[model samples]
Target: MHLDPFELHRPTSVDEAVRLAGELAGRFDFLAGGTDLLPNYKMHINLKPHLVALDRVSELAGHSLSRLGAMERLSRLEQDPAFVAAYPGLADALADLATPLVRASGTVGGNLLLETRCFFFNQSYFWRASLGFCLKADGDRCHVVPQKERCYATFSGDLAPPLLTLGATVEVAGPGGRRKVPLEKLYDTEGDGIRRLRLAPGELVVAVDLPDGAAGQRARYKKLRVRPSFDFPELGVAVAGRWNSAQVDELKVAVGGVETYPRRFDELTEALVGGPLSDAKVASLAEEITRRLRPVHNTFLAPDYRRRMIGIYVRRAILEAREGQGG
Candidate 1:
């Protein structure tokens, strides 16, 4: 196998890194853990040029929980509990990504910025060469199911699904300046070239601002894959908001490993609002969900099977959230 040649850049500071990234513009690729990028290079899937490693940028690594600890004061209020409760689900989601060894080296900024995946596309150049290139690779068509105009790669990151459910905002530093945007909009609908991530040239994701969920809001991350662990999701669901209350308030639903971005079925969520949370209601909502999702045959499982499981997982997620909320 032939390895692609690429230049590597390591800046000592975030400011320097951002500047370097800005100067390099679209020509450079950002390196985090190299778990995904290295394999792509080895497979000849990408001919990388000017790799800017973010490892030297200390600001992107390490996180603080002191803010959540500060919320302990709110426990004093008898009528309303403190916001410390919101951290558990977020912490749990972060803790659940990959294994401990990977976590030590992996950064939150990298995980959130990871590229979308497709079983048919994320292969060695040899594999794609044999099958011919799909839309995501060098090829012009989708191999999973031909006659498609765009790539059908699934966004396989586990953190993104749950983070969107929590209403997290991403902070990125670029040449123009620093800005924050809803993490949900970071992905684009067009899957052929990379999904719509608003990452500007010379921009680096710094930290993500996660809005604390309400005291009653409960969230869960459920992923379906061939293996029980270590494998990327074939279908992932993240459900958040106050499902435990008698009246449903704001709800956030995001699904991954099935589409270009984490998909939020707002139309379906609206159908369930103000209705009793029941098995019957769940069943009815499942139909709406099925209508909204269009999964392709790109993962380990069949597209039809994946589509069917979408409803199953959505129903199960709601039930689980309700149970957690004491509904």
Candidate 2:
């Protein structure tokens, strides 16, 4: 309920932030909007001694049509008519993250790096201690899987799915220096919930680079949560592609909120790219993806129901995006 005291370091540039991170080593956390990190901190989940606040880093702050800075606020993106029109699925994600109040302070990078969550991990300090620890935080074993090897906490962020569908790339800065990587490659597919991202230690996301191929691609994002607002998604599906007449020119589907990390179905989508996609074909694609998912009972929703709805949400998203026009 209360924040334990910690040293806060404000760096005005990315280089300075990375240097500070190296100095602090494993003892620090990069604070963006603090919407995600602070809440976890208050719950006494993985408390660090130092905080590197990135608010003063002006370089990570703006958005043109082609690039979205890491520190750019969700509310700011949601309000831009041009941006929303250009990346409608991303707009849906931004608007659907938490509430307007939270979104006002929720930065893009924070949400992208949002902590994986589970019923056992996100409890009060006393409650967590009383119940014993989980692998995601203080404990060694996972309550959900009842094992010491892997954690089953679900990926609850909304932006990654839509961004993944767009074939976006991220600019990363660290002690090793700067580089860009495909958005899907940013997630560690082989890692479990406790070790989700592929980022190196002391590295931070700089910005999201929207590729030229992403331009004017029709896209849709569908999220299923406990409520229409505030609650984290139980199932989130995103579909993006361009259609030439009734034939699929390019198609990609990425799903989140139901697994350890958001992922794209490139192989499946690839097969349909050059073919004429009918309603039945879309339905089959959705069912196949749903069948492949293995969501556990980690979040509020039951895994069975979430799994069942995956087919429906994916079907709906693809159907809607196919008809919609941006290009």
Candidate 3:
């Protein structure tokens, strides 16, 4: 069936884009790679009257590395010098999204600001229609986990987990003014309306900043999905920490697919601070953090299984980050 008809606008600068978007507010949408947006558009999701494309704005495309020289080195004996020196955990996080072709076209801004997702929520209009809409899609009540007052759609993207661990910040330009905020603040715990991105009317994400400390910190992302590749995460964890001599000095963790927003396990973070990067402590911390997670049945897997896997993947991520610390 044909999707709804809409107007499209291409503005050359951030100011212009914001003005048009603000002027059109509820009627407009800011387009990135059309990666996730277009599909939802076709499904008659939000029903905006216009598509405000951000393609002409040149600022959102490139990426760069910051210097974090104080951190410990991960490996030595340099083999494939590029591979040996490269930040695979960081690079791989970006590379692992959808596919190379999609990556080439996909904007980092779009990926960071993706809408929350779930197995029951992301279907085509016809598919959703057949089952009746769940809380996230069309209907008021959640079909995936009945009696739930709100939606439990999982936020399942790869970039966010690592970015959050790396202490990435998002910059936005809008009618209100330009501002940058920690990516962590962009999300809230609850899932309805699902997006935690706090961009205002006419605002568009300009660039993402990876802090200098984040560049040097040892970080890794572990994603559990049904397929080996390309699928959204069933459970994902990103952990970044630095070792000061022999003790874990600082740690940042971000988890996806188990909640409405990518979440940080503060209790575990507090426990790791000033503690040794020992195997036992990390495992115990993971176990303790898993107990705090509240996974729901919106995903393909059972909630109990997803909840248990969060701890498993969390421990794996911690070990990977520790491994990168270079004993």
Top TM-score prediction, candidate number: 2
Give each model's whole-structure lDDT. 0.67, 0.90, 0.70
Q: After superposing candidate 3 on the true structure, give the runs of residues whose Cα lies further than 4 Å from its correct spot.
A: 66-87, 190-195, 325-327
- Order of all candidates by lDDT, from best down to worst? 2, 3, 1
TM-score of 3: 0.87
lDDT of 3 by residue, 1-327 (tens): 356888999987778888898789788788777778887877777667898887776654444454211111112111224432344455556545566556555666677778888766677777887887776656777776676567677777777787777777777788889888887877765445444556665677777776766655677777777776577788888887787766888887778878877877665687769968788887888887788778877778788888888888888877876766411
Candidate 1 per-residue lDDT, tens place, 1-327, comes to 656678889987778887787778778888877766777778777565888887766666544432111011111211122323554344434445566556555555656666667777777777788887776667778776576576667777777787677777777788888887887777776545444476666777777775654334677667787875467788888788674355666666778878777777776777667756778877777667767878877778888998898889878877777677421
Sequence-dependent TM-score of model 1: 0.84
Enumerate residue pairs that collide in model 1. Answer: 21-202, 22-202, 133-139, 188-196
* Top lDDT model: 2
For every model shown, what is its TM-score relative to the native structure?
Answer: 0.84, 0.98, 0.87
Selected candidate, larger TM-score, 1 vs 3: 3
Off by over 4 Å in 1: 1-5, 65-96, 190-196, 212-216, 243-245, 270-275, 325-327
Question: Could you tell me the lDDT of residue 213 within candidate 3?
Answer: 61
lDDT of 2 by residue, 102-161 (tens): 999999899998998888988999988987777788777877888548987888999999
lDDT of 2 at 44: 92
